[model samples]
Target: MSASHTHGDCCDHQDRHQFSLRKALIPIAVSALLFVIGLLFNKALNNTPYSVGEYAVLIPAYLISGWSVLITAGRNILRGRIFDENFLMAIATLGAIAIHELPEAVAVMLFFQIGELFQDYSVGRSRRSIKALLEVRPDTANLKLGDQVREVDPKSINIGDLILIRPGEKVPLDGEILSGQSQVDTSALTGESVPRTVVTGETVLSGMINQSGVLTVRVTKPFAESSISRILELVENASSKKANTEKFITRFARYYTPVVVVLSLAVAILPPLLIAGATQAEWTYRALVLLVISCPCGLVISIPLGYFGGVGGAAKRGILVKGSVFLDALAQVKTVVFDKTGTLTQGNFRVTDVISENGFTQSQLLALAAQVESQSNHPVAQSIRQAHGKSVHKSGVQEYEEIAGHGIIARIEERTVLAGNDRLLHRESIPHDVCIVEGTVTHLAVDGEYTGRIVIEDELKEDAIAAIQALHLQGIQTVMLTGDNQAVADRIAHTLGLDQYRAELLPEGKVAALEEILDRASHTQGKVAFVGDGINDAPVIARADVGMAMGGLGSDAAIETADVVIMTDAPSKVAEAIAIAQRTLQIVWQNIILAMTVKAIFIGLGAVGVATLWEAVFADVGVALLAIFNAGRILR
Candidate 1:
């Protein structure tokens, strides 16, 4: 079948699995009742010629329970794909019937069907859990048109249109609140429990619930491009990118089933001829038991299910892992590198200190610097203007010139004012006593005389220190890279207790530095991960072993290039992501070892004639259910 058609069939099967528990029970109930009746009849007959009556009831019971398996096996045989679980089941039960072991044949098929029922129910429950975790898509929007409000599909609402959100309603689209105040619940998007108070001009994303007070919001993005839609799409497509372990299991199953089938055929024939004491009938029965026990249903289903559960669990914590492959990579990460601004720090600059010289008062220096730097859009310039707290009139400013890579030089009311870094001071032949400042310093020069400096700093994020400490506790190294000077980098690094810090590196230099970090981490050590949240960080984000992005306030380029997106924008989520990855891999391996060890022991027992057909059924289906339940534990 074509890929699309196969996917459609798979969906149909899942839909049936989701709702077919009651339907499935009916056939098994009837088959089980008939099997019981046939057993009683055979017991009462006790060597009479009326044994045909036992076959009469038991044949229908076996057919009812095993018909699907037999049909699927036959179809696969015609298509030259006979080595599968269904074929193993079909041949084992048919061999039992041929040897006149009617009760064992009926019992094997009946219990196998029961096992399949449990598997379906477990899988359906898992799918429902994941769906509930991510069911953030709003159904309708309350659109505000003129004086009237009308409900409409969220997809029909366009950007720039106003929408009214009542208390307890989910925000229909990404928008900014234009009026009113409310405490909005962001747990669905950020996995945070506390409701955030939002007011006029505050941006509200889709999937957030308004908790109190009616609000009017102007939509910023269409429904298709909203946060909820992107999250759904990311998770829905994650399974396509399988982990290496999942792929190995799949390849192993393909070769394993056929090899077991060949060995089973040899067991049926070679044993009777090679061993004089072995009877053909006894060896054939043992060969049938071996075939049933050797089915690889457990390993085939549980590995992928384990990874899927891991992804779902992480999503519940507001961490978006793009694929199982990334989760696997994250489990091996020994060092996490972070971009200083935005990722580790708040990226909001503020004037922290002001030093005066040449008899210039601190207030006077700040006012003059703010006025000169008014036209520049640099962050440091904005912080100075904010600290000054006054509007600059264009009439009082003239001859404004912005020196690239240096600072701003403007004529304020015909008095030359230079508000820039030390480079601008040196380039203009202005002398200053304080050449080196601890933090980001913007020097001021009034008419060839240096007038003190303003020290601005970016504060560390609230969770930065906690995040670093958590990584250290996990025995992973923490490092920071930034374009800021070494002094600022050292201060932030020391405050956070980071293992290493690289300062004053440009974007290209960050990539080169990352390459060195990767090289230093030998194959035996582990991979290196980079976390960043800027347009400049995209290249390094893409180059790292596992790239993480701060999605809440992160730039589009960085988010798009990242392998993992931390929606809460908390530095702490980085440690949580690694923890989740490691836990997921642990669960997956547990399932693998559990399935393999049980199968190996049971297969040996069946080949040596120590295990019956009933035990063989448990080996095939009982271990499968165990592994599936183990995989589902990740969701908990």
Candidate 2:
């Protein structure tokens, strides 16, 4: 762990909120103290209606609590940007003061400041959750300079520079361990509590804490491009890309605020001027109440805060929904497509069966196949090498060649060894009996004679079946697409009870399949999500309505293209993210309905002079507080 990253309790998510709360308390306490003093002197004693001495104390109370808001309103009005909550509060409270309702005027600003403090607290909590990953990297690194070490800023360290990480220090940058053996805690970045053991030649990422043993690391990435930095950048900028609902609310407020102001103007002037019994004092008081009721504080604060809290909640659960737009889309998802390998099944391949031909022992055929396949990084090749249980001599191979999809051909010793799929043997004019297998297989030939075949099986993830069942229960249709052979894809798809499966799909084919699913969802009034974790899946991830990446063990490309990233290598997180999105939307709608319904009734009452200025404070600031409380549930 870096010096900054301690093995502290995971429940340390409250520090930021506490800090914001401290700053908010000063204003809240001051406003409430002065407002209460004004109330006692003006209302409780002598049944005093209005007095010059009262105005002296009450006006100062309003100014103390709301001077910033008044200044902002004045500045915005001068800048021709006047329709906002600040303007609404400023106008309504000042109008009340003009009518000699000193207590109500002071109360309005005081309560509004309290509401703002709550907003700051709630927003601060959400921000901490979203930006928690920013704490992964240490502020400085122990740089190695000419056999001596000195602490330096991580930003100042260049790529390929050498650094030392002692026990309890966070790895400052993405680097390879030059010399060390230690278990590094990666929970901060990957969200997995288990510590990963690392040794020489192993790559470690920035933000991981070294549990034990000192490591000399060769940095591979600069601080700016490190994992933690990229994730922070993605999260910080996510809010800028507003959801459709947010855009609609923005447009609604732009027209709605001005319209309400004009209506309040008509209510104040028209009825009193035209009607014989109507008095200017009563009508203008009603107009002031109307202004407070019309402020869109509830809708404006609750909607975006709802999404912000949702994102924060998701981060707490090890899921990263890049933006509110993706969260909204995930809630409406009806079709979920999955890339077979690394998504549904463990990408790790294991040799399950071996066959021999040409009077060769299974062991000999395995050894020859392993030697030829050693040069390839394909999962099948790795599995074959692992199964052989013996290392091949590098000098034993004369010539080696890797034919893209066909596999490998090499001159092992004096004999030519061919190890690959059925296509490789056929291309080499070698005849071999077709082998029946349920998983991926590599057919081998030696010196123009058919040697044998090895079958490699990819086990399904422990949670794959459960994840599929969960989606099914949610009424989401599931599909699987892969480049694997038809039989293997068919069996896995059937075993998992998926709705559909497409086999032998290339990278482009996955995109084509995703487009078709999206077209279908468009007609069905739903969204389509594609789950994947590879470079090949990146394009499909970017094309889908919502892309969920298996962030842990997933390729960088897939994570970058995905709209949502499941921090663990679990398929079940997809369902978890959807549940969060749905809950978040539910809270947002609840707030919208509650705010609108209450405001409408109050606005009607205020226009007819049936509601008092005190009631107007409840309509605006009180409703905002209630809606905010409703929105906070999304984070929990």
Candidate 3:
């Protein structure tokens, strides 16, 4: 089924109106004010012709818009380390004044101020997207004390408290349901779009909303231990983990600024002395112009802006990228491993068949099997109970034992009841078919009599095929790893067009599979991503180059380990994320190229005595404006 929800419309009416006003009126206000002042000052200085008050109006305009920036630039320079944006802008505007080009200097500063304002506006929009993703945290939770209901802070909720969840309400804590039935939207936590029907004895995650029925859940984790809180914390601080790209930019800017400064000085001094008849003053001025032109502001801003934009964009679409590193890593990911059940399929069990081997009827076999497995809290056992229509009375059972990693054995109505896998039946010397190639089958026996088998299948998600197809289109190889039987795993892998499959993998076995893929990636781009929607798959998710969690399902462990999260259960979003990252990186390079190109062209002209101080101001300021415009594409 298809679902839709609007995102990121949180701005208040006044805030939105202010944003629109700023966009429409701020520059115009500055420009019109400058023009009117120039006229008034020109009239006032009519007697003194040398006043040049027409040009002097720019000074007031510059002060209005560029004062804060100029002060910041001065402070940065005084600190003995001055390779920041403010330093570059200060040098460029000041150099224009050196040549006595008053109007040009004012225009240059004005344009720079406008560019900075645009940058601030765009970054603010990005922050809004981040905030929207974070707004999923609910304000309150329903706590049940005996028969009474109380509303309290979600943060104050503790483990084992019965939290009542209503239809259309987000499940406040990760817990097991004690009563009622409902379909939960786990898309936020699992990246699976289909809503899962959860009844009594089923686990529900925090942030998952109940679509139908009322559920009284026994919280298994505290509010602090809840998945939603951890996810919010991880995403909020993702910027702290510097990706290789960010580090490279940092190191590049650190050295590039110093080298450029030295080169500018060399250009100013060497040419006049070495070349005959070359003027020292002219050469010095040209070198300063070159320094003004090559500020590297575009390079610094664009690169980080690109990643930030990509992260914000993905977040808007319900994907939380922990850092720029994950965005970069995701682009380089050639191999992607997915956890089978919650990641690939819906992770809900449905009864496929009820086979009666001997002379027993189907209803008789189901009653005996459900009676034996009713005490266990396993998916397969739940499926058996579900088929039986209601919870069986425990009064009929005597000795009930749940074997780890196997099935349950119980004594019901003076008879030995075994409701488990074929191994449980074989151990009891019960005769039954050992295997099937279709769905997962659980064997049933009563007093050493082979009753029958019930086949169960975890259905694939509706968009599972589309999501896999989209991944393949992005040139990523998809693989499935699961602890399920080979036949079940293979069926899903085949249907989803998975490039590879590893079946019957234990939880540890999934980790081993990830290791093998990581080893192979070392020969290629040295990157791999693991996507899982389960708590058990957290280890493998962390082990991969980029850990991706389906946050819609609200798996706390998955959210903690994964570097990237899909807030909506849309597999196709994987492709969208990769596309956004690639696009962002491309835009960063484009801005860098555009800035350097204009600087190089104008600097060359300045050295040849063709580009004057006015031209120098234009090159410095105009290029900065262009780069800022290019960077805005990220918001789009």
Candidate 4:
């Protein structure tokens, strides 16, 4: 058994023998004792017993499994905190024993303990998954001392301390690589599936695994202040920030448990003492029946279990649902607003075609374009330089000047070159033909003559169309928002078959669009969700009812602000997130209805004379067991 699993009197479930074989032994021992005693009594005397001894054998089993609860309840009663679950279980079981219902009392406690065990097992499994993501603070790091490697705690490893990372080892601290290159798996931090390649001069984060090559890293951040550690802390404390449903259930149980206890006491005592004129034993038996019916086991436990299961389940699938409130919000999301660049399309720019004019070769036009744009750092400039297929030499370029948002002007071998849109050519009074091409076009001009134009565009994401269709199937309204011009936006939107499209929006414009949708959705039965992947989109992400981040290539600000994070860059995960949320909500409602229905039936039966103490005990524990099992179904 793992040492972490050992707690108080609870058997360590990690132990193979205790969890499996020992549990199997409990029923066998009970059966043996009961059967042997009954046979011996039958053989010795002439009286044929009704197998009553079989029920008596259950006492040892119940005490073995649930004695901790009984002790805890007794301790609470001695103090003043007597209205808890432990107290409820103890009272109900003791009442059943007083009514001469040994089997029922033992069965109820046994079944309840079994449910508790199951919860512990499920919780342990989830804890394992959570721990897998949590990069624990490393106690020691391999710091280079002279020519040899020495072991030192991560805290002791200061800035510029060279830490050697061997194969299959986690990076001890965040720093820039001093030497070597390797594929670092960052699935723990971003929940992404692929490994990221990192080389010298590039930054590497702590808790990432060095897959194959060895690396000598320098420690930049302190051990206590690492990003992975901070994120783990956030995840651990996430449960404390409960949803409205979680708070409601907790409050509901606190009042509901005490009320049921009082009502059960009244049902047991009032009628039998005044109206029936029954004997003390007969009245006490009825009171015990009342206690059994008023257990409240189902409602008290299942609601929180349902939500916990939902959150943990979503986490397993690489979706970081912050809390139950966000999960609930996502289930009812109708309008999904998407940012055009990184959210719906691959934001990377690629050169598509080069349309040359005035008898200029593609190479000559591209070289002139690259020389002028060498002084510029625009995305289009980068795409043009990358597609030129030759290294650019800035020695020939003289007097380079940037024209703000328009373009760039430079002198290459005394030839005036302008590499920008038609706006720059028009502003410079340079004559240019209207050479129309699809997507984004970067015009090139040399000596006031139109040389060529490079077509640079952002491609649509592979699953963009399918993702929108999936949302439509779920009756959700999909909307696209972009800062791109109307013509370009319309081309991408129409290709994706989106329900609605809005183009030419600034950062504030996008926020206004989200607010309008949210206002409209407030009157309806759904929430407004914004999906974006830029720093400027953080305000809109925070303002929306539910914010989804496209991870992998997503910005740190966007991922940090969003409620749900899709680990992959694929937009199709948006639909998957909604589907999972809807499923979780359905499971929660099902558990609530089932628990309430069973409680109502048993409570009504216990109030009258129709049900016995044994039947009431079965109703309480059986319903609780069923509801817990139902909650666990979500994990599967």
lDDT of 1 at 483: 74
For residues 80-152, write the lDDT of model 3, one tens digit per residue: 6566555655665566555544455566566655555565566667767656535556788999998899999
lDDT of 1 by residue, 1-636 (tens): 222221222223455445577888998999999998887877764355656767788899999998877876777678876677777888888899889888889988888778667767766666664576466689999999999999999999998999999999998889988999999998877778899999997789888899999999999988888877777777788888889998888677778888998999999999889997999999999999999888777777777778878888888787888899999999999999999877888878899899999999999998888888878766677789899998777668899998754788888877888887766787899987855567888888889998898999888889999999999999998889887777888899989999989986766788999998999886557899999874558888999999998854324574468889888869999999999999899988998898889889988998899999989887777887788788888777
lDDT of each: 0.83, 0.81, 0.71, 0.72
Off by over 4 Å in 4: 1-63, 74-80, 98-100, 135-163, 173-207, 216-227, 351-437, 440-455, 552-554
Residues forming the 10-long window of minimal summed lDDT in candidate 1: 1-10
- Residue lDDT tens for model 2, 243-325: 78777777777888888889988999999889999998888889889998887877888888888888888887888888899
Clashes of each: 0, 6, 11, 0
lDDT of 3 at 269: 88
Q: Which scores greater on TM-score, model 1 or model 2?
A: 2
**Order of the predicted models by TM-score, top scorer first:** 2, 1, 3, 4
The RMSD of every model to the true structure, in order and in angstroms, is 4.4, 5.8, 6.8, 6.7
Clashing pairs in 4: none
Backbone clash pairs for candidate 2 read 1-169, 1-170, 1-209, 1-210, 2-169, 2-170
Which candidate's lDDT is highest? 1
- Residue-level lDDT tens digits of model 4 in 532-605: 77455788889989988776222466546877766567788888888877887887788778877877886677
> Candidate 4: lDDT of 547?
85
Candidate 3, superposed: residue stretches over 4 Å from native: 1-28, 35-58, 78-80, 134-154, 157-228, 269-281, 355-378, 392-433, 444-452, 634-636
**Global local distance difference test of model 2:** 0.81
